[model samples]
Target: MHIKVKFLAYFRDLFQSREKIIALPEGARLRQLLGSLCDSAERHKAVFGKEESLSPHIVIMKNGVPVQNSGGLDAALENGDVIAIFPFIGGG
Candidate 1:
């Protein structure tokens, strides 16, 4: 499946590319996309942070709302889904 992915904040800086069309397997989730992105980029370390650890504050939205646990990135993705990857914001 193909989807539109937008990186924000640190992730965007790491990617060096604001947006791109990524191709994934039939079923792909937010988490899986992160993994793939990291794998495909040299600066992935800066975007994903600690190895094997998903940033707790990282926010991933599908269409418009938060991904329901994103099924841990194993979520099924459909064609043309706009994935907005944003950093968790704090107002304290």
Candidate 2:
């Protein structure tokens, strides 16, 4: 299956692009895609946490909607789904 993944803001720089299409086995979960995307230790730590789990500080959305209501990291992704990754931001 193929899904579109987008990395926004600082994540884009980390991934070295804003978006890309990734191929995964059918029934792939959000964590699979994340693990495949953040290959390096630096990228992995930035996206995933010290515990190797999706960082709570990072914002993840599925097809324009937040994934928290959809099972979060375990969310089952379907073909053609769009996953957007955004780093946490704070400004005064």
Candidate 3:
């Protein structure tokens, strides 16, 4: 299955692109997609914490809804799904 991932804010600079099309096997989950994207130690650390779970600073949305509302990293992904990645931002 192929999914589109959109990188925003700091992720854009880290990935060097605004978006990308990634190919994964059928039945892949969000965890697999994130592993594929974090191709390096630095990238991995940026996205995942020391325990190998998603960093609290990051936010992921699948098909316009926050992944947390679904199953988070265990969320099942489908072909043509649109995933957006960005850091959580705060304002005064």
Candidate 4:
């Protein structure tokens, strides 16, 4: 299956772009896709935290609606799903 992914902030550094079309296996979840896209331990650790958990500050949305209600990274993503990921940011 093919899915569209959009990254924001530092994530773009890892994938080299803010958006792309990726190939994923059937029944892949958001977490799986992210790990595949940013698999390197160092890279994952840099974009995410510990490479094992979704950083508390990371934001995920599907079709512009937050999937936080989907219990976070566990959110199931189907083909053609549009995922937007954002890192925490602050301006003072």
Candidate 5:
């Protein structure tokens, strides 16, 4: 299954791109896809917290809706699903 992952802001620097086409196994959830994408421990922690929890400051959307509202990282992803990920940006 091929899914589209989009990186916003600093996340692009981490993934080395603004978007990528990720090939995931059948029945793969968001967590599995994320784990595969984060190449290092630091990068992984930045996206998914310790114990594989989604970071509070991180924003994740599946198909334009917040993932938490749609079953979180446990959400079932179909082929060609679009995932947008990035840390919440704040301005003062």
Candidate 6:
């Protein structure tokens, strides 16, 4: 399966691209896709916390819907699915 990942805001610089297409095995879950994206230790630490959970500072969406609404890291992924990642923005 192929997933289209979009990096927004500072994530574009962190990932070194605005977007990327990742190929994964059939039935891959969101967690696997996230693991693939973190190709280095620094990248891994940036996206995941000590417990391997997504950092609270980041937000992820699948096909325009927040991942949390779909099932989070365990969310099932299908071919052609689009995933968008961005830092959680806050304002006063």
Global lDDT of each model?
Answer: 0.72, 0.89, 0.93, 0.79, 0.89, 0.91
Per-residue alpha-carbon lDDT of candidate 6 for residues 1-92, written as tens digits (9 for 90 to 100): 89999999988888999999999999999999999899998788878976988888889999999887678889999999999999889799
* Predicted model with the maximum TM-score: 3
Q: TM-score ranking from best to worst?
A: 3, 6, 5, 2, 4, 1
Better of 2 and 3 by lDDT: 3
State the lDDT at 89 in candidate 5: 78
Residue-by-residue lDDT tens digits, candidate 2, 1-92: 99999888888788999889999999999999998987898888887776666787899999999887778889999999999999777799
TM-score for model 4? 0.80
Candidate achieving the largest lDDT = 3
Give per-model CA RMSD: 2.9, 1.7, 1.2, 2.3, 1.5, 1.4
Q: Where does model 1 exceed 4 Å of error?
A: 40-53, 68-70, 90-92
Ranked by lDDT, top first? 3, 6, 5, 2, 4, 1
User: Lowest summed-lDDT stretch of 10 residues in model 6?
Assistant: 49-58
For model 2, where is the 10-residue window of minimal lDDT? 47-56
CA shift of 36, model 6, Å: 0.9
TM-score, candidate 6, is 0.92
Q: Model 2, which residues run further than 4 Å from truth?
A: 90-92
Residue 63 in candidate 6, Cα distance off native in Å:
0.6
